[model samples]
Target: MTQRVVVDPVTRIEGHLRIEAETSPGGEITGAWSSGTMVRGIELILQGRDPRDAWAFAQRICGVCTLVHGIASVRAVEDALDYQIPPNAQLIRNLMIGAQYVHDHVMHFYHLHALDWVDVVSALKADPKATSALAQSISSYAKSSPGYFSDVQKKLKTFVDQGQLGIFANGYWGSPLYKLPPEANLMAVAHYLEALTWQREVVQLHAIFGGKNPHPNFVVGGAPAPISLDADTLAATSVNVQGLEIVKNVIARMQAFVNEVYLPDTLAIASFYKDWFRRGEGVGNFMTFGDFPEDGTGDPSKWLIPAGVILNRDLTTIHPVDLNDPMQVQEFVAHSYYGYSTGKDTGLHPYDGQTNLDYTGPKPPFEQLDVAKDYSWLKSPRWKGNVVEVGPLARVLMLNAKGFEPAVELTQKALRQLDLPLEAVYSTMGRTAARTLESKIVADQMSTWYDALIANIRKGELAVFNDAKWDPSTWPSVARGVGFMEAPRGALAHWIVIRDGKIDNYQAVVPSTWNAGPRDEAGKPGPYEAALMDRHTLADPKQPLEIQRTIHSFDPCIACAVHVVDPQGEELTQIQVR
Candidate 1:
């Protein structure tokens, strides 16, 4: 008999998800379906409000990267109003963004993604002394911890022995894909606890400027900091080098762990569970809306990582990210509930746009191409007419292809240090390492911009902000603009329309909208759907932790799109029990 196995309300990650895998009687996996069940209408909520407030309103979409939305929303409005922010304001934005990348990347690895892979149960067997020795042997940055990991281990041991998982209460631990030895698991577990502290310290970056994380309020005209300009307070205007230094040190430690600990751990785990690399591999197409600090200039291409597109299984580059190029971008909502003019192109400004909601059951993007059916509210997304991967994996692969010499050199060094083949740099392990590597690049670029800002300030050239005055009256009789920025997740796009000074319409295509999206009109499965098709299922369903680990690696953030909930609560609760 064919069986339908459901893993609903996946825990330990942001938002809600219910995955159903269909198995044939012969025990081979035949099909999979991804479902999202949440309802958030930020778009609908902002229907008649002042366009400026859209930034304030949209920023509430997600707590982790609230500032990103704030920036994107305001930028979208500013694009609508044709306003330009000042130089110092740009620097502040860059600094906050830099801090965000550091904070989000670290949190993703340690708190969110680590538990999925790191075995808490196995940690009880690790030797503190051996872990310390291992730490000191790999990188001196670990020395800064000074028994931090040991204390964390002791705390975890207490929690586990008490059978009070607490922070780990909802984690999937007994999954078969967890392949770490007891000692390694123990070491990773301690780091996981230590990371909670590390993550808070990183958040201080956002606190200093935007005031708070999880939706910082820095917006269009300028950040709210409004320097007093007093000589003494101007002195206070000095960049928080100490905070930046802490972040730098934390990143150094992270790189060390990636090189010394995590890389080796991944290889060891993958060796034991090689089936992962062979299966769950989806369409090899990848895309990156490139990001990095500006060299006191507006030339994005000169930024550390230039934006680009990649296609095909072997990964080839396509240059010059042209948002207006019709052949380069299109959206098909055939399977989505949203109403739009059929065969609409995302490039043709939002002013001349249409949105309609029509729903149809799971259907293939094309004829003779159904594996399973999508029950997701997400629309199947395609990039410039092809299926493409996004996130750290796509970013890393694109950077690797661009031959960004620094990233390339560092990646090679990372692979060699772990005694792993260079090919290993191409799998799930590669995704984790790429995030850390990108963190280093961003941190370094941030320091450079800091120095440039100081030079501009000393030269009395820092423009705090451009005038926010705009004749909402004379505004383009009919204007449409699209804003694109690299969010921590991947490329984030917002399409805006303005008529008679009120938002005629606004649409945001977020990162989750791409990664977790259902089938588009063409019937192509989104990236995550294709990736999960061939995963190995354990004999015990309760141990679906591997699924959790693999999916979390994408750092899926569904909040920006919609809320996913499970109505069949008892059925889900029972799966956890068995």
Candidate 2:
């Protein structure tokens, strides 16, 4: 007999996600399903709206990755009008996006994903002196003293003693799956607190350039910050000499944390769980839109992360990705709570994408989703009819396959340190390790971009905004374009169709949608479902910690996946997850 285990509203992630697994009598998972229970009708809302104002609305897709959608939205409009921004503007965008990668990755590791590996209850048993020694052994992060870890332990003890765990509530605290020792767990807890303080300082870079952190202001042509060297104006008023100095300091601080803390912690923790490198290798194909353009946006060769697809884990050949090619990329709604104009089985390219809600699953508060019928709100997106995993791992693999020296060197060094083969990168821990490595790569690149920006400023080239196509009246009567970038989670692309200067149709195929979506018309399991099946086993199905470890590895941002609430407003299943 197969037992069905359900974990609803998967916590620590951005939005609601439910994971249902079928386990055999021996506890090995035989199959699984991934569902985004809610619907995000942002595309429907975007229709008939002014194309220039789309960024403001689109940026609200997810509060966690606000600026990513904003950047892609404006880029879509720019692509439609053939708008070209200044070199300095490109550098600034690169710096901002790079900062997001560093900030987002660090936070995800410490706050969101660390608990899966580090046992909090065990941390209370840890000797602060031993933790301090362990911290120092890894890297020279200044807050490695015994006193610092002691304080963190005391705070955690207070939470556990008070019968109120707060964010740490209902966790499988002493689960057998936790591999890190008491000292290592204590060390991680201390850094978790430190990162809380560190993130506030790092976000200053975003505020300095974009006028705010979350939902930062992004213009259609270029950045909103105006460059000036005038000493008379206040530092807050403009991007002056003082402002530039602060930006440099922020970049330095970001680099310091990635090197001294994030990278070391990831490797140290990963060294304890080598088995993870063999499991959770779902849908071996990988894809990346390729971010951080070194030159103008039009050329793919100049991109730091190249846009390409590697099928069946074949590093020998990288398939090209053409956004305009309708036959190449398409989305199917067969297993989703959506319908198509042509038919439910039909796959439509993003350019002609449709959002028609047709919920035919079990009502709310149900035990399991009707996997045989429509289940999730996320449409199954396919790259030439194959499921492809994206995000940091994909980017790193692409860089290595393309013979990018820095990425290749870093990947080899990591693989050697872990005593694992290159193929190990296809698993869950590989995703986490790849995130840390990419942070180092991106943080180092920020310094180069910062220097370029300073050089442009020193040469008296203060131009940031381009107003050539600011007015929608200058656009063609009918225009369509695709704006794509590699978000912190994975590949993200926005497709827009404009008619008479208004958005006729808009579709955002986000990273989470690609990774966490349901099955397609062909009955092929998506990335999340495929990973959970065959290899996963539940030591305790009630606590489902094993399920969370794999799901959180992808950093599922369901807020970016499903947005709109059903007007009928039926209360579905309510399950508590720590």
* Model 1 vs. true fold: TM: 0.84
Candidate 2 on 295-383: residue-level lDDT in tens? 56567788889989999999989999887798889999999999999999999999999999888888789999889988899999999
**Residue 556 in model 1: shift from native, Å?**
0.6
Q: Would you list the C-alpha lDDT of every candidate in the order shown? A: 0.62, 0.89
TM-score of each: 0.84, 0.97
- Candidate 1 lDDT over 498-518, as tens digits, reads 676777777776777777776
**RMSD for each of the candidates:** 6.5, 3.8
Model 2 residue 279 distance off true place after TM-score fit, in angstroms: 0.4
RMSD of candidate 2 to true structure, Å: 3.8
